[model samples]
Every structure is written in C-alpha cells, then in structure tokens.
Target: MGPTVTLLISIGLCLDWAVRAQQDPLPRPTLWAIPSPVVSKGADVILRCQGHLGSHRFQLWKDGELRDERNTSWQQAEFMLRNVDDWRYAVNYSCRSGQGPLWSELSEPLALVVTGAFPKPHISSSHYYSAITPGTTVTIWCYISPQGPSHHYSFALLEAKSLEPLQRQSPTGTPAAFSFPSVRAEDTGSYSCVYYRKTAPHMASWPSQTLELTVSGFLPRPTLWAQPGLVMTPGANITFWCSRPKMSSLGEVIFTLWKAGTQEPLQQQISAHLWTSFLLPPVRPENTGSYSCTYMVQTASARGSEHSEALELVVPGSLPKPSLSALPGLVVEPGMHVILQCRQPPKTFLNSLTFTLLKVGTPQPLQSQSPAGTSADFPLLSMRAQDAGNYSCVYHERMAPHQVSDASEVLEIWVTDALPKPSLIAWPGPDVASGANMTLLCQGPSWSTRFILHKEGSMDTPQDVSQFSLTHVTPKDSGNYSCRYQPGTNGSLWTQPSDPLKITVRASVPSNTLLITLSCVSFLLVCLLLLAIFCHRSICIAGALHRDNLKRFFCCPCLPQGVCLPHHAEAPRDEALYTEVAKERPSEPSVSNSKDPEGVTYAHLNLRTLNKRQADPKETPIEPTVYATVSLD
Candidate 1:
C-alpha cells in the first residue's frame, strides 16, 4: 500500500511539471535564409526556420502570404526553393515554429535579393531619335515586356559612360516613366536604364540598349503669311503660310499658331517644303485677335523658339462713320496752312479702326493711324486753289482692307495756293522807240486759266490777256506794268501782283540834226544861180550885134533845137563891119569894181564870114560858122 501511494504522488508531480512546461512561451525564432540578401538566378536557396523553443516544425510567409511549411525531427527545419528565379525567392521572407497543421507568430520579415533575374528595361524617349531641346521638359520611360503588377518595378536613368544615376522615383507599374525638367545641354550623352522589384533591390536586369540623347538649343522660329492682306472682311476666306526662313537640317518641323485670347491654336508639321500652308474656309467676327507663331524641330521633342510679333486682326460690325472738319476757317488762303481733322465716335476702340481723308477725283485716300480717342489730324501746308474739292472721311478696320463705314458728308475745300505771285517780263526792252511794238508777258503756274496785265496809271482797267502788246508805241504807252494770274473757278483766286516793269518811249529823230541839213541845201542853190547868169551874157556879146545884143544880159529861153540861131543868116563880111557893130552895143552895169566890164574879157571881137572863094580851096572851102567876135569896152 505504501509503495502504491508513493508512485501515484510521483506521477502527480510529474504531470504538474509537464503541464507547467506546456504553458511556457513557444520558441521566438530567427530565420536563416541561405544565400539571403542576394541570390543568383536559377541557384537553389534554402530558408531555415530555427527557434529557441523545442518544436522543430515551422511555417514560412512572405508579405503576409504563406510561402511554405515543414515538420521534421531536427531543430533546424529548411524550406527549399529549387529554382531561385521563382518569384517567391525574390520577395520578403519570414518563418515561425509549430507542429504539423499548426503555426506560431510570424518572425520579423526578412528581405531577400535575387541577382540576374531580369534583363535591363527598354529605354526610349518621346522624340523619334531620343533628342530633346535644352531647357525644356522631357520624359524617359523604361519598359518591361509582360508588364508586372503595380508598384512592383523601380526604375533608374543612368549616364552610360559614368554609370551615374540622377535620381530614383517611386516604385511603379511596368514601364515606369521618369521626367527630366529643364534639361540642359550638358545632359547629352549615351544613356541606359534598368528596373528592379522593391523586395529584391540588388537584383536587376542587364542594361538596356544605349540611347544617344542630344540636347540642342532653341529651334528657329517659323514665319506666318496671311492671304489677301493684313486687312480682311468678315466671312472672308483666308490662308496662312508658315515657314522657317532657313533650314539647317532635313528633319521635320512643327508649327503652331496661337490666338491672343484663345486656348487652342493651329498646328501643322512639314518635312519637305521650307513652308507650310493652312486655310480658313471662312472667317468670323470672333476671329478678331492678335495672332502669333512658334516652331521646333521634330527630332527634338519640341522646345520651341520665341513667338512672333502679334498681328492684329479686326472685323467690325456697325462701325461709326468719321466726320471731316477744316481748321481756322472753311475758306483757306494761299501761303497759309490748312488743317483737316477726321473724327469718329469717342466710344470706339482706337485699336479697331483707322481714320482716312478722301477727296473727290483723288486716286489715293489719305489715311492715318486711329488716334487715342478716334480722331486724327492732317495738315495741308501751303494751300493751293487746286486744293479746292469735295472732301469727306470714313472709319475702317486695319485688318479688313476693304471694310469701312459710309463716307461722311462732303466738305468742300477752296485752296488758294494757286494764287501765287506772278513773274513779269517785257519784250523789245524796257526803253523803246516810239513806233516800235512792245509786249508785257506774265507767267504763273500752268493751272492758271486767266491772266491780267495792269499799268500803274491804268489800274482801273486791266488788260485781260496772257500777253499785253502795244502797237505804234508812244510816250503814252510807256508806264509801269505788272501782271497776275488766276486758277480754277474761285473768284478770289487771282494771284498776287507781279514785279513792275518800267518802259520809256522816245521820238524818231533830234531837232538839231534836221536844222543843220536844211541850211547846207539853200547855200548850194544860190551859188548855182550866179554861175548861170555869167554864162548867158558872154553868149549875147558874141551874137546878134543889133539892138538885141545891146540889151542887158538876161537869160533867154533856148532857141529851137538849142541852137542860138546865130542871130543872122550872114555875118559881116569883114572885121571892120564887126567893129562897127561892137561899138554900137549897149553897156551893162557892173557890180564888182576891180576891172569892170573890160575885165569881163570880151573886148576883142573877130567875126569872119567868107563871100569870096579861096584861091586854092581844099575840098571846097567850108563856110565858117556864123559867129562874130565882139569885144566889150
């Protein structure tokens, strides 16, 4: 009985001890993964679930998912992965201790790394050749074929030559994209990329194909061309030509046209022509805005050049008309400046319109930029009579060349510039002979239709002629003369007086010259009369010794046939008979005293008439001419 009791007590004590030991804490173990932290591709690796607790059975879990379990007699239990390339070998790992079909608290998670499990991710760019414009944003994406789960891939962009990485991004799905902002020219060079899982950070694929990334300066800007003209009308069809002034490469170009206030812009591309063309089927009033353009080389993911200057386009509806006005006075005078004003509604926008002045019969319209308040001023200096014309003005849009308001009421201008001072000239000299002809000439502008010649004393009536001519000029015709001209129909358009031209008229000959000529003629006639009387007396003494011969010497009229008739048919037969006749002759008075009548030299008288024949007559004696030689005593 005593022995039985002792055995039972001992059994109870043993049971108590066993029960206490069962209540003790299970083993908190640490896992030993063979080839942990980094593992080779396709290499077998083992996870040893070991614990300080007595139980040898264990379980393994990764990222909260059960990976494997095992129960063995050995204190160290191992879960083997035949091929390390399996996804399970590349994830977070942990172990716990327990019998079969039972589990313990999971051990702290263990991170594992599998090397050479994946090839490098494919690297590419948005551009055709992985080129980018400096100082612009660019995106590089690393792609893994057969895309993996989200947040499973980590990507890096590395400089190939240096194997240096700029930075890393958050884990993402396959084909992870990395953005580079404000890229610079120095970033250019050979580049590569690779990707790995967060769990196996050290394990990655081979480097992707090397990509040559080129960073370039800003691209050249393209030019914009609009159809028709800068000005346009509403609903007008227009075309635009965009081009690069020059080309340095064969790569294509992208062009974009931006509207001043609109979000969307027109875009186009070209690879061949230096220029590109775009067409607008029809325009609208909403199209009124400033337009500009920009461009980039297609090979460079479009870091654009600066935009062009904005070209204003306008399409006005129900625009206000402009009014025309003259400054100072409506009637302008020559040599004075005239001011013309064009005014539109003050409420109208200055940028939307321009002012213009139009004259009737004028081919060109005088225009100016719209003033700040819709008014413009024009000055017509040195007004002319020809400037007189119907004038008006209108408001028009700058962009729409032909779009304009109705012309304002006509404002007639009477320019007096044509009434310029005339020039005068005299023909035949300023001083002239009395009987000569003279002319006064007036000259002015060719437009002058009328001319007037005026004399100083005869101002009351001016000669209406181009040239004033005086025939048979006398002293009365000599005076101060001037001329003026008129242009157009303006009665007040007569020109200023021309410079005066002085003239003088003189008589035909001088009095002193005529008096001397008459006296010389009278003296010559007296001398001729005295000589004639002397000759007649001499002839009387020689003929007619009768009473007629004694008559005082007085000239007798010529006898018939101018022969003195010899006064006798026969003369005295002898010299004695002639002597008697001479003695009987009457004496005539003598004037000068010196020799008197004897000095006359007629005292010797010899008269012979032959009654007897000569003794020896040659060729029959010719009768002597009946003559008597008489002497004056």
Candidate 2:
C-alpha cells in the first residue's frame, strides 16, 4: 500500500464521523401557556417553547401533529393563537427545538380547555336563603337539562366577577356537586358553574346564572330595653325598644320579641330604621317574665343577629300590698347590721311567698328572700352610707302562674355621721344653784330640722328646738351633756356630737357649817352619858338606905332646838357610877333652896362616916368624914 492511499482513507473516515455527529438529537424543550391552560370563548393565548441556548428552530404540535413551526434567534419561541374559541377545547400541545439537522425531544403535553361550546347549565346552592350563616356546610350543584344526554361530564365552579375557576369535578352522573365543609365570610360572592363532555373535544356548556351568597351573624347584637321601667304595677302598658348599632349597614330588618321560657316569638315587627318599639298590652300577673329580642336582615337569604341582653318585666299589684319595716329602727351607725323586713298582709291565703326588696332609684331588686313564714328579712351587713335609701318590697309566688303583690310602703333608712358636729352651750352657766332654772342651747347648721340633746348615762331622744329647759335644777340633773343635729325630720342620720359640757348644782346651805354643827352636838351628848355613871357610883358609897331606895338621879342635858338626849337612873354597888348632871340656868337671878343663886342646878350629897376604935386614933386624928358631889354643867 502506498502512503498517499493510507492518508486518503483516514481523511474519508474523519469526514464521515463528523457528519454523523451533526445528526444526533438534542435535550427536550419545555412547553407552557402564557395565562393559563383554561380560557373563555374568543380569547387569545400564547404557547411558549423554551429550549437550550444555541437552539435555532422550534415546532409546536397539537395532538401529535405539527401545528406550527418557528425559526428564531432567541432561546424561546412563542406561538400566539388568535381568537381561540370553544372548538379548541381538550387540545394537547407539545414543542421541540432544532439546530440545523439536529433536533430536541418533545416536551410534556399541556391540556388547553376552552369554555362555552353548548347551552348554559343550571347552577344552584344548597342554601335557599339570600344570606348564609358562617360555619355551615354548603354545596353547589352544576347540572345539564334533564333532557340532555347524561354521560361522562365535568363541571367547573367559577367566581363570576373574577372569572376564576375555584374547583373542578368530573362525575359519572348528569349533575355534579362541589362541597365546602365549612363556609366562611370570605366565601360570600357571586358564583356560577359550567359542565363539559370530558372527552377528546372537551365541549363545555355556557356558564350558569350568577348566584349571590351572603353570610350572616357578622353584625353586632342589638340592644333591648323597656319603657316605663322594668317593674310596673298591674294594668300598666310597656314599650320595648330593639335598637341596632348606628354604624351597621342600612337594610330592612325584622325584629322579634321572645319570652324566656317559650320558643315562639311574642311579637314581630319590620322596619328600616335602626330602632323600633313593640308596645305590649296592659300587663297582668301572668305577664311577669324575662324577655329578649333579635333582628334579621330582610333579604331573600335572611340573616339574623345575636339576641340582646335579657329584660325582665315584672307585673306586681295583683295581691294586696304588704307592710315593710326596718328592724332596730331606721337609723343606724356605719358598720352596724340592719334588717329590712317585708311582711304579708293579714289573712292572706297565698302560698310559697317570695319577697324582693327594691330600692327607690335602682332598676333591679336589691335582694330576694323566700322565708318559711309570711315575712322576709333582707339583711344589710356592715351598713354604710351607700346603703341608706328609700326602700320598699313586693311579694310573689315562687312557682308558676306567678302572682305578685303590690309594693309595701316605702321606709327610709339613715346612717349617722353624715354631717358636722353641732355646738352645745349652757345658758346662765353650766354650774347653777339648786332650784334655779337653766337652759341648754343647741346651735347647728341652718339646714338642721331638729336637735338632740344627749346626757351622759341617759337615753337620748330627738327634739325639735333650739333650747332645752330644766325647771328645777337639782343634783340629779348634773351630768355631762352634748348635742347633735338631724337634717331631716324622719331621717336617722345625725351630726357628730359636740364637745361635752359638765353641769354642777349647788345646795342652799354651806357644807362646812353644817358639818361643824353636827360635830358639836355629838360631843355634848357623849359627855352627859359619862356623868350619869359617876353619880350612880357616888350614891352607892353611902350604903345607908336599902339597895332599892338608894338610887342615883340626874337632870337631862340642855340642848339646842331640834336635839334631844336620853336620861336614865339606876343604883350601883361598889363600882364607878355614872350620872348625867345638867345645871338648869334661870333666866334671871333667883334665890331658891332647891337651886344655886348663880342659876346653875347643883347636886348635893350627905355622907355618914363610921370610926374605927383606938388603934388608929393616933395615926391621923381620924380624918373628918368628907362628902363630895359630882356635877356636869
């Protein structure tokens, strides 16, 4: 073989290998729609084919047949389908990219759906009302006419205004249902449905009629209140007002009144205003019950608001009025306990009585009590100024066919220390002579209706006056005194007490002089008793007469007027004898044998002495017999 022949054979092989490399296939391209795969009738669409950077040609295929081919310098080619309509439904599209003789594999297929190929279908919701309540299950049904062919059909639920399909369903039957387990506020809008054949040429029916769905229970609750008060006497008319919020949307509404224990509405009213009133007939005993109200938006799909707070209507006065009283009086001090008692009338035949205590200005009962007896007591513990008010009570049967009694008479309760202290002054001085008249003046605020003079250690009583007089002041009247003022005639409240003033009563006689006079008289009587004992002893020493005859005697003592002394005489033997000797002084000098010339009464005694024989004669010349008399002048 020659060198030239071998070189030509190598060149021919190299050239053949290069030509084969240029014929090999490239990587697959990507195919997608510009807006979406689904389009309404007569809409334009763009099918884009994207491939490798150096690719020069792109071919679009519909149902495996070449529909269009494009020569482009860019990496992606867009095929614009102008006036795309319903006949183009169920179209499967793909694309491939080419570089000279080399070509890329086909892309994934896309199903393009066109709607409105046949007559419109009928669309409906499970809810019949114009408005739907939230949290409820809702189902929308799309179906062809009954006469239409029942075959494999698909449905699409679309938002009419947005032109967006929310869901799709393919069912074997003629009618298809789309379900929402729990509908919400955002689900409220216009909705429509359409059906298709679900086959190669997916011919679709026109959209159904637009159905409006609204949600309820989003408005605030209305306010219900009664006119002429919650509690009323028999035969009184009441008007209940049901009012919606001012900012709520304006619409026709139906207001319904409902009794607590009954399911049926008591009344219903329709109005366009925010508020409306329901006037009830004259009330009776059987009319006492709790009430509430609600309003509904008056539309094809009516929506209702929450019920208002309960309003209780009380019709009392069917029975005779009861008596009400305050125990331990109406006036009480703060922190003290008080009982407001309601009692049934005598000879009343009602049973199972329940009592309600009502304050004058309070809309509701202050308290309730059901006693075993006919009376009920409402105790106010730790009473304060806030507890003071005019109160009354009414009684009713505990069980149904509730019969009520008229309110008892109003009772007023007062709490002391609501006012300032008053000033108490004594006229003609706090200290006055006994039997003199004195007055205690109470000065307080000009608004005070009455004054109360309080004496220490005595029960205080309210008085209407500026001065309290003491007719005959005595030691018994002496005490600490104070005063307080009451602002109302019937009120129990009082002002704080004034500073206490002490009263002292002086007697007629000087105490010191009386004491001295009593002491002198006592001493004189004591001395007379001693003198009588001496006189009796002196007579016993004589021993001349018989014991019975030898008696000692003395005169009674001279005493001042209103004074008297006791005198008695008795004989004593060999002992100190006491006698009371009193000298009676004559008014003028007199000479009498029985009395001394000095006008002083004297006691005279004569003694007989016995001498002893010779032995003692020389010792003391036998002292002459001596006699002595004792006297107290």
Assess every candidate by TM-score: 0.27, 0.35
Top model by TM-score, which number? Answer: 2
Q: Candidate 1's residue-wise lDDT over 35-95, tens digit each?
A: 4444557767777778654576777887777877667787668887777766555677788
Q: Give the per-residue lDDT digits (tens) of candidate 2, residues 503-614.
A: 9998767779988998999999888988877555444332111123333333333323243222124434443433432343222222242443322223222222222232
In order, candidate lDDTs are 0.63, 0.74
What is the C-alpha RMSD, rounded to one decimal, of candidate 2? 37.8
